[model samples]
Structure formats: structure tokens, C-alpha cells
Target chain A: MTETNKTWVLRSRPVGDIKDGDLELVESPLAPLADGEVRARTIYLSLDPTNRIWMSDVDAYLPPVGLGDTMRGGGIGVITESRFDGLQPGDVVNTGLAHWALYNTLPGASLAKLPTLPGVPLTAFTGPLGATGMTAYFGLMDIAKPKAGETVVVSAAAGAVGSMVGQIAKIQGCRVVGIAGSDAKCKWLVETAGLDAAINYKTEDVGAALDKHCPDGIDINFENVGGEIMDAVIARLNDFSRMPLCGLISTYNATDPVPGPYNFANLLMRRTLVKGFIVIDYFPRFPEGIQQMAMWLMEGKLKFETDIVQGFENAPASLSRLFEGKNLGKLVVQVSDEPK
Target chain B: MTETNKTWVLRSRPVGDIKDGDLELVESPLAPLADGEVRARTIYLSLDPTNRIWMSDVDAYLPPVGLGDTMRGGGIGVITESRFDGLQPGDVVNTGLAHWALYNTLPGASLAKLPTLPGVPLTAFTGPLGATGMTAYFGLMDIAKPKAGETVVVSAAAGAVGSMVGQIAKIQGCRVVGIAGSDAKCKWLVETAGLDAAINYKTEDVGAALDKHCPDGIDINFENVGGEIMDAVIARLNDFSRMPLCGLISTYNATDPVPGPYNFANLLMRRTLVKGFIVIDYFPRFPEGIQQMAMWLMEGKLKFETDIVQGFENAPASLSRLFEGKNLGKLVVQVSDEPK
Candidate 1:
């Protein structure tokens, strides 16, 4: 084991887009664990749009990562050492809301041992069988309440939660349409993810595409992106449509106050229900979600991707791949090699 | 009964604000009543913020008032002649989605007969027992689902729906705060309506005032006026807050696309539920709402005001009172004298 631990510390709140020096990757000597504490080596650190939200000095769902602190994040890791019962060294676990670090020292009670599923890679725990998967499950099935034959629209459809949301809605017998930034992502949404149609928001006119595709109008909008894309979907919403507002990746790093959907009034006109949510809110119901998702995974009903960027040192820079739409599906930083 | 009917007909769709020639007061001979039709003498024509919405070519809750057609409105009227069963002459009925005219010809089945409650004046139907009252009733009770001890903030607090919302929320044991345009409206909100606090958005720093008034944070926002005022309340929303989006009077007349609330992201951060609604959507449940509101009124728990504009000729002009914040409560145009 290395004598020093490397962690990205929040340096300053970003004004618009994240820049160099906003976070500093610092090395520190690993301290001895207290009783009931476990030290885990990060195998895959999740690079989510919400990481940008945590870096900003704003009133967010969780408190902003305080300056000079190890930047807050989620990760999959293997326990290197344990003081608490049940959790043993070499047991792979989920480090919930831990740090963007090579090694995380946490209470053993706070960690969940990841069950090994046959034919599923360890990366699946960071994608389909992870927090992002549960987010898609609860946000769509719980909030959006997709009914069979309902037209479901998902933004950021090629991304982690969005991809899962599209597939889940499809499994529920909904006519699923996805909106992505790139033609490649759009193609992947329809071809690989089994979406009914996919709109490349960067290339196609979203409203026109939606009008052409969603002939019956949108019944459920799994909103992952906010801005004009949201406005377009909102405008064409069917009477009594439901929108599970899971993210606003479009405005995460906005310097100026981002304006909400232009067709906000349409929500009232159409009697649409828009509920904002974070996956952590559904933590208590994770078992139900996981069981259902795992069943779907085992049945070959769910497909997912992981864009792994090599190295823990590149954690801060790799986050930009999400904002810039450079990565597909779940963006993860491979901090260390898995135990063979 | 007069041989000719005076009706305000839409002349042109307003570009920003309604101007001269946007609507014309035209006189036309009353056509003979068809089977199931009743000729009603318009007594109290409700002038609401949605009147401006109907005047535009925008896609609204109801279809826009077609250009060159009689301006669509809601009114209380007495049946002068009926070709349908169960409805008789001298019965005062709610002319649902009728016209801004001296007389409205509507199907007897579509009109609801107003029940007489001793000590409740005819105007109460237009104020607390009518559509606006029902809007306040369901928007707060049904969508917002206010819990006892929760903080509820209502915008356009002096208007028909807002004033009623505050009183109902108070009755439900909520801490009610109101945001209105003028000191007089704010004064009435705090004193007469029994709200915890009131902020004059026109004269006060709305955000600062909201922070002071809603110390615990807003749990329910019965949004009426959407703009900066809505933005301020949205910013102070607590986790799991509910927003019943009833109206956007602020954006009704905007020439350009109105920007939605800047604190739109706060909705996601707080996991708020925002649902848009129009009162007509709750038509089936109006009896329950009306019974509740009427009981409160008789018990002296509900206080109301009616800003009656004299004459049908002034119906088009009286609508400006709603937009300009000139009216205290429900703004209604008295088209004719009530039956003596």
C-alpha cells in the first residue's frame, strides 16, 4: 500500500464552467482508522453533473463541498481495512457520498457490500445496479408513473439515469423518445437502448422533431436536461402529463441565473405534474428498486455503458466530459485496479 | 328585453397589451333560441387575469377566443327564456364559458343554477362561490395539500383566487404569507384575511421581505402572478414544498417569450412538486369545494371582497384593473341590474 493518499480538494467555487485550479489534487499521509471505521480503495469514482453542483457555493440538495475539503462524490470501492464486523478487507462496497479520493475512510455501517451477480461486470454496479439505476427506476416508475401506451420523453437520453429511464419506460410498454446532444448518442438511444425514437438536440429542431414523433403528445417527461429542451417537451405535453425532474445538467455551471422553461405556463394549461427529485431521496426504497432492476438486468431487458477515464489524478478534469457531452452513459474515473 | 344585444367582439389579437380596436363593442340582433338553449341576461361578468390570455392567439387551457367572435368570459345571469326542461325564467345561473355581452345564449344543461344562501349577497357567487373561489379552493387543498403548521405563500394575494387561498390555508392551520402589488392589498391580506405577514412586491425588496416573513421557508406556493414575485417565493421553498401553479398574470401580456422563475433549480434542490391547474378541470368537484367555502363564509372564517365595475360597456376596459393591480378582490362587470 502507498504511504500517501491522493484526494481532489475544492479550491474555489466556479463562476461558469469549471476551470483548472478550481479543485486541487493533494496528497496526504493515510491516518490510522478509528474503531468501527473502514478504509476502502476507490475502484470507480462516479463523475456526475451533480458533482458540479456540490462544487458551487449554492443552496443545493446537499451542502456545497466546503472550500479546501475533499470534493464530495459517490464511488465503488473495495475495503482495504476494516474495524467493524461483517465488512472484511477485499469486500467490494458502495461508498455513498464519500470523497473523490484514491482511498476513503468511512464508518463500516455506512457502506453496503455489493453482491456479485453472474455475467455482470463490476462496472454494472456503477451503472445499472447502482444509484443511477435506482434513480431511473424510482423517478420514472414512482414519480412519472408511466402507464402502458403513454408517450415518454427523456432528455440526456444517452446518459446514465436517462438511458435507464428510457429503457424502464420502454419495459413499462410506453412509447419512449429520447433527446441527446450528439447523433451518435441519439443513434445509441434508439438502436441499443430500444427507444422508439431519438432526437439529436444539437442537430435537429427539438420542437419540430417532438411534434413529428410524439403525435399523441408527451405523457411522461423524465427531465434530465433543463432549458429550451424542457420548454419544447413542456409545450407538447399531453393533458395531465407527469415530469420527473431528476436533473438540470444544462444549467449546472451557469454563471448567470438560468431561466426556467419558457413554456412553464403550459404545465398549468395541460395540468402537468412536475416533481423534482434526487436518487438519495429514494434510498429507503433502494431494495425494491435494486431487486426489480437486477431482475431486468438478468433477463437481458436493460443495457448500459460506462465511459471510464483512467487515473484518480484526472478526477476534476474528467467531470467536464459530462458537461461537454464528451462521454456516453455513466461517466466514471477508474481510480484503481479491481482485486483479481 | 332589448331587440339588439351588445357584445364585445375580438377585433385583433393584442401584440403586448390590449389596445383600442383589439375588441369592438358590436350590436347584433338576438337570434331565436334553439332547442336546449336559454337566453340569459348577463348580470355579473367576471373580469379575470385569464381574460387577457383568451384575448391572445396563444394555446391556453381553453381554446383562445377566436378573432371576430364574441369575447369569451364567465358571468352570472338570469334566465329570460328557456327551450330546455328543468330550467325556468328568473333563475340565476352561472353562464359557464359564455360571452362578455348584455345577454348570453347558452345550453341550459351547461349552466349551473346559483343556490340562495341567506345573508350572502348575489356578488358572493362571483367572489367566493364562483370559479375563482373554486380555483383557490382546489389549487390549495388538492394540489398543494397544505399540512397544519406548514408555511404557505400566496402571490397576487389581493386578487380573487389569492385572497381565498390565504384564508383557506389559514383555516387549515398554516402560516400564510401574501405578496401583493400595493400597500392597501398587503394591508387587507394581513389584517382582513388574517395572514401571518404580507409583502408589497411593488414597493419592497420581494426577496428580502420573503426571507424575513417566511423564516421557516415556504411549503406551499399558490402561484397566481408569475414573474419576479414567483421567483422570490420559489427561492425560499423548503424541501418537499408544493407549488400549485394557478396563473401567470405577470406574463399574460408579455410581447416576448417570458422567462420563467430564475430559482427554477431550487425546485430540484428542494424536491418540490409543481403542478399547473385550471379551475374548469375541477368542475366535477366544485360542489364539494363550494360547500366547504360556503360553510366557511357562513361561519365568518372566510372574508371576501368584490370590485364591481358598472355596465357591460366597460367589460373590456375593466379587465385592465386585474393586470394593473387596481382591483382589491374579484373584479366583475355588472352588465345589468339583478332581479328586484
Candidate 2:
């Protein structure tokens, strides 16, 4: 059989915003799966802000993608052929940090069989029940350690991890406020996600909005969108406030070196705790996070959105959805059809 | 029977670096002490970087000195007379957040009496045994939690808190690296404070020096001086590193808003814990910290430096010693004669 694999290959490191030709879609013939290997056709490809970090030749949490190598990403796929035990064709699996390709030939041991939860769709494996959900879970629960009645503020409140963060904080019995780019996103955060309040960062003065909302001052800052929004939050943090630094989406596409929050001195004055973390660090605890998040989902307490951009050819261009605030919640690409 | 007291009174809030008219040496007739009040003559006035912070009308750990009020400071003083039960004439006490005055009339109940340690000078109270000492102790012990083999990096390594931080880490059996302004201060940190290495930030490429000294990467950063030096340290932090941010002396005098470390994103990439703290927060546990630090001092495991500037008139001008990096260690102004 002459099956072909189409993959996004890193042609050059992105200078600032990812421009054309920095990555190229290259086609190659698929190789035969060896013993203990599995062939899975991509169903959903997770496009995140961190993807921009991976394409840069900088020291990030993970090594930058090597020039000419397959563009690294996270995705969910359905097994087409398997040579290892406990696996069969048509079984869905999570390709942990896999290639942005139509077909991924991975070691069967490395792929986790996606658990089937009632009423949960396959796209959720790329969102609330997957890496993004886990990111929001541990970042808030473990780092922020929210307590009842505490004021919790989350940036990028309309984005994947952020939406979950606000909902989780609300579940924890805290007064949650969200910061998002658009008024529509802000409305969704308060109306759908049940945040105490939501600020439209693009149209409103974030500092003034935060002041009006967080009268008692912010006890926890779930930092995602850094820069001015972060500075505004930092300035309003209460004494001994906790900040779980999940992502700096605002600085991901910058050409020059990004300076930290302008009100960084407030961190000292307020005696705040600022911690930076990646969700992958809590991989071992994913079962715990997913189980808890799943319970909330089943209870109708958690709501999530998946902004799916279809086609394998659109992977690179689709990443701008996150940077430009075009995506409502989780941004992903539908590379192939989900099993019927 | 008319004795007068001279005080450094806040005339106007300083915009950046404190100027001559921002504070004035105002002399007023001393008020007669009421019951439960003590009259103390200032022995040593601590001239610290935080003094500059208090001079600015910005929100800080404590309320900024109100215009026309006595400038807020920490000092050691000899009680001339006391009406409260425990404190009496000739007793030395710590005037907690008192005024920068020749004589302070304070409530006797609020004063902490100084214990006479054999061979320990009064100057030591301002250095390794006072607020600055407590700043280093808790910031390192409670926040950093240094391990035996860990590499600890401290900026402003020759200053009051920094010097003690390096020594405390040394006692913890960690490789301590110091970052200071001068070659002389660098020599003192390595030779006298027993630091493993010292980087002259002014004369050396701090990043290159850190690379050469800290082969294992920095596990704890006792951040006293924030700016370029902080960025250099942040870039090389080990995974799960802890940063106890005690001070940001480098930016205290900036006329414009000071931007944080350019490599701030590395804090996330490295999963670093950055906590801003003030020594006053650890007041309840001071006895525990002082006990351990005092034990090390008596065991010859800890050494300290006191950079004394003479006269009450020079108190305002002497604060420049900290900003200009002219002081070797603990900078204090000798306000009045020490009791014989």
C-alpha cells in the first residue's frame, strides 16, 4: 500500500510573528510499523501559544524544534494498525507531543489509550479532558491553592486553560474574575462559565476594571496573558497573593526581548508569590485532574469550547487564532475525521 | 529645662532620587513623657535602600511617610527614661519603625530590649542581628530552603541582607555566589563572608561569570538587586528553583517606571518560585531565626560588616551610599553617642 504522510516541517525559526515559509508542509511516504509500534491517523491537533515558543531558537521548557524537523504539537488520533498488545484498530489514543502530521507512527507504549467518558466528545480530549484541562487544573489547585471567599483573577479568560481556571476557581468557592480580549468573550465568561465578573481588556482599562471588580484586592492571579494585563493585576494583588504563571501569551510573538510586568515592584511590596509552571510537569497527576474535571463536566458545572480549524494544510496559519484572540476557547485543527 | 530634639522631617515626597529639600532637619522642643511612654536617644540610624522607598509616595510595605511628619526609619537607641514596668533608664531597645530623630518618644510596650551578647558589638544589631539580618535569615531559610549541595546566588552580595544571606547559605553547605558592585566588595564576600565565588557586576560580565562559577546552575536566587543582574540569574536558574526577592535597590531611585528582568519568561521555563518578602512579616518567628543565626555567629561560622557614616546631619545624604554601592555591608548613620 502506498500511503503518504503529510507533515509540517520547520523551515526556519520565527523571528517575531510566525511568517510564511518559517514552516513548510512536506509530503513523505509512510513507513511500516515495527513490533511495539502503532500507526494512528490524526483526528485533532492542539494548536497553542507555546507552539510559537517551540519554533523559536530560545531556551524554553522544551528544546526548540530543530530546523527541518517535524513541527512538534499535541494531538488525539485513532489507531489504524498496531503491533503491540492492549491496542487495536479504531481505538482512539493521545499522541503525546507528537508530529503535526496526518499519520503518526509512534511507539505504542508512548501513546495513551483515550478513555471513553459518557457524553464527552472526541474534541474534548484536546480540551477539557486533555492537556489544556490538566494545565488549568494543577496550575490553580496546586499553585494558587484557592480558598473559600478569596478573589481569583485569571487572564486570557476566554482561552482554553483560562476558561477552565475560572470555572475551577468558582467551584472551589472563590470569587472569580476573568480578563479577556473581546466583549463577546467577556460575556461568555460571565454568562456561560459563571465567573463573578469579566473584563474586556481590549476596550476597557484593565486596571480600573480590576479595581472596580476586586474591591478586596486579588488574592490569586492565574496569569496567562502577560504584559499590560499582568501589570494591572500585579498592581492590585492583595498582601501574600499567589500567582500561578501558566503562560505569557502576550509576549510569545514579540520580536525584541520582552520585559516583565511594569509593576514588578508591587510583587515585592505586596509580598506576593509568583510561580511559573507547565502542565506537562503534572503529567503523573493527570488521572487525578481529569477525574475531577470530568466529574464537574458530568455535573454541568464545567463548560468548554473548541475552535476547530479544519485541514492539515492550515496548521501553521491557524496558530494565529491564539495570538490574535480570534479563537473563543481551545484552538485545534481537525487533520482527519473522527471515527464514526 | 528646655531640651530640643532634631528630626529629619518629610517636607515633600521625592520623585526619584531624594533631593535636599525633600526632607529638612527640623528642631522642636521635646515633649514631656506621659505614663507608659519612654524617651530614647538614637544611637544608630539605619540608612537602607528601603528608606528611599519610604521617601517616595508610592504604596509600599508600610505607609509612606506623611508630608511634614518625621521620616520613618529603624534604629537602635538608648532609653533615657521609662515609665513602663520592664524598660528603664540606660536600657537599649529597638525602635521598631521609629522616626529618624535624635530622640524618639515611643510607647514603652512596643520596644524590644537588646540582649547583651558577650563580645558582640551594638553595631552587630544593625548588621547580622537586626531587621536586615532577619531579612536575610527568613528570606533564605523559609523561602529558599537551601539544600547541602545546592548553588545559591545572591545579588547585592556585600550589602546588609546579601552579606548575611551568602553566609547563611554557606553554613547550609551550599556553594554561594555573590554579585556586587565593586572589586573590593567582591573580595570581602569571597574571603571574609566565605562565599564560593563573587561576581563584580560593574567590572565583569555577570552572566559569563555566573556561568563559570555556577556549573550546576542556580537553585536559589536571594534577589536583593533587581535589573540586569536579576535577568542574568533568572536565565540560569535550575528547575524548581526558589527566588526570595528581598530588595530591588537598583531601581529604587529610577525616575521612570522600572521594568522587571528582561529574562522574566525564564522563571516560567525553569519552573522557578519567585517570592517577594519583607522581614517584618517574619517578626513573630524572629526569636527562632535569631537563635540559629546567633549560634552561627558565636561559632565563627558567620561574619558581618557595618559601614558607618557619622553625624545626624548626614543621615539623608548617607542614604546615597546604598544607591551608589559605596557601602560595604550594613550602612548605618551614627546619630548620637553610644552610652559608655
The alpha-carbon deviation from the true structure for residue B133 of candidate 2, after best TM-score superposition, in angstroms, is 0.5
Q: Choose the strongest candidate by DockQ.
A: 2
True contacts kept of each: 0.91, 0.94
Off by over 4 Å in 2: none
Q: Estimate how well candidate 1 is docked, as a DockQ score.
A: 0.84
TM-score of 1: 0.97
Q: Candidate 1's residue-wise lDDT over A146-255, tens digit each?
A: 89999999999999999999999999999999999998998899889899999999989999999999999999999998999999999999889999999999898788
What overall lDDT goes with each candidate model?
0.91, 0.91
